[model samples]
Target: MAKSNKPIVWGLFAAGGTVCAFVIPVMILITGVLLPLGLFGPPEASYESMTRIVSNPVVKIVLFGILFLALWHAAHRLRITVHDFGIRNDQLVARAVYGFAGLFSLIALVTLLSF
Candidate 1:
């Protein structure tokens, strides 16, 4: 018997979801580790520490990449989620959801660049 291809779509979705699951927690852990280690400086760290954190070229680039990918991932997943819930009304909803996600992502990128 030949295997069906429909399962492939589900598999891809699962893979993406798994990545998201891991990415979110791992990012959180990094933040926790770095903050306590004073990568952003001590609890008493002043504006200087915050400034230093934002000034690193590598860190800024990585942050921008992560932000863009995360937002795109979120929008794609949310679109599927809304569809799964049987809200088959129009394409507008999906567009709006993805559009808003991208817009916010761009805003974050700009803010990060400035800092």
Candidate 2:
């Protein structure tokens, strides 16, 4: 039996999909729906407040993880989708998608670290 690294990528995909399914909707509800509708008093939606919230190291790490995983998840999906569409060049597609994800992940990490 040949061992493969597919499990690691699949794990990331699952985690990201879970986050997208659960957390992203709530985030949209809070920031997109609730905040705009003034559901809560004075709308804790100020730029300063947001800055403060993300300033915490733990928060930064969490956000970065979510963003990173989501990017990888999307990239993997895209790779599979292109393959399904008969691109016929799995290696090139995989590299392009994963490279894009990696570049963005690095950017996200750097931005989070800066904050």
Candidate 3:
């Protein structure tokens, strides 16, 4: 049997999807709803607290993982959606989508580490 990379791809896809599913909605609720509504105390307090939390190295690594996984998950979905739309040139689509994901993941890593 020919060796295949499907398992590796699928593993990342699954892990990313799981991370996105658990994290994204909570993030949206906090950043989108709670913060603006002042449900998390005052703006200054929230900003200061968030800064403190993100400044920790461990937190930075965790945030980077979440951001990277989320980007990859979205990119994989977009790639599949493009394929479903009958743009059968999968190599191009996969490269474009995954490339964007990789680029954003790198950016996220840098940004997180800057803190």
Candidate 4:
């Protein structure tokens, strides 16, 4: 049997999906609903507060992980979806989607490290 690296990608995809399921809703509630509606106290949603939050090394790493994994997850999902949509070129689609994910992951890493 030929061993493949698909497991690694699948693992990332699963992790990303799990994180997104748990985190995105809370994030939307906080940033999208709570802050804008002024239901929370004193509006700690300012630029400075955001900057401070992202400034912490731990927070930066977590954010980067979430962003990178989410991108990869989306890419893999799109690739599978394309295949399901009757695309016969699996190799080409895989390359394009994973390449896009890698490129964006690099960009996110650079951006996060810059901050």
* Model number with the top lDDT: 3
Q: TM-scores of the models, in the given order?
A: 0.64, 0.79, 0.85, 0.79
**Where does model 3 exceed 4 Å of error?**
40-45
Q: Is candidate 1 or candidate 2 better by lDDT?
A: 2
Which regions of candidate 4 fall more than 4 Å away from where they truly are?
31-45
Per-model root-mean-square deviation over C-alphas: 6.2, 3.1, 1.9, 2.9
Candidate 3: residue 20 Cα off by (Å): 1.7
Give me the displacement of residue 27 in model 2, in angstroms.
3.0
Candidate 3 lDDT over 1-115, as tens digits, reads 9999888887888999999988899999988998899986897989898889999999998889998888888888898899889999999999999999999899888878788
- Candidate 2: where is the Cα deviation over 4 Å? 29-45
In candidate 1, which residue pairs clash?
38-41
Please give the lDDT score at residue 57 for candidate 2.
92
Score each candidate by Cα lDDT.
0.71, 0.86, 0.89, 0.87
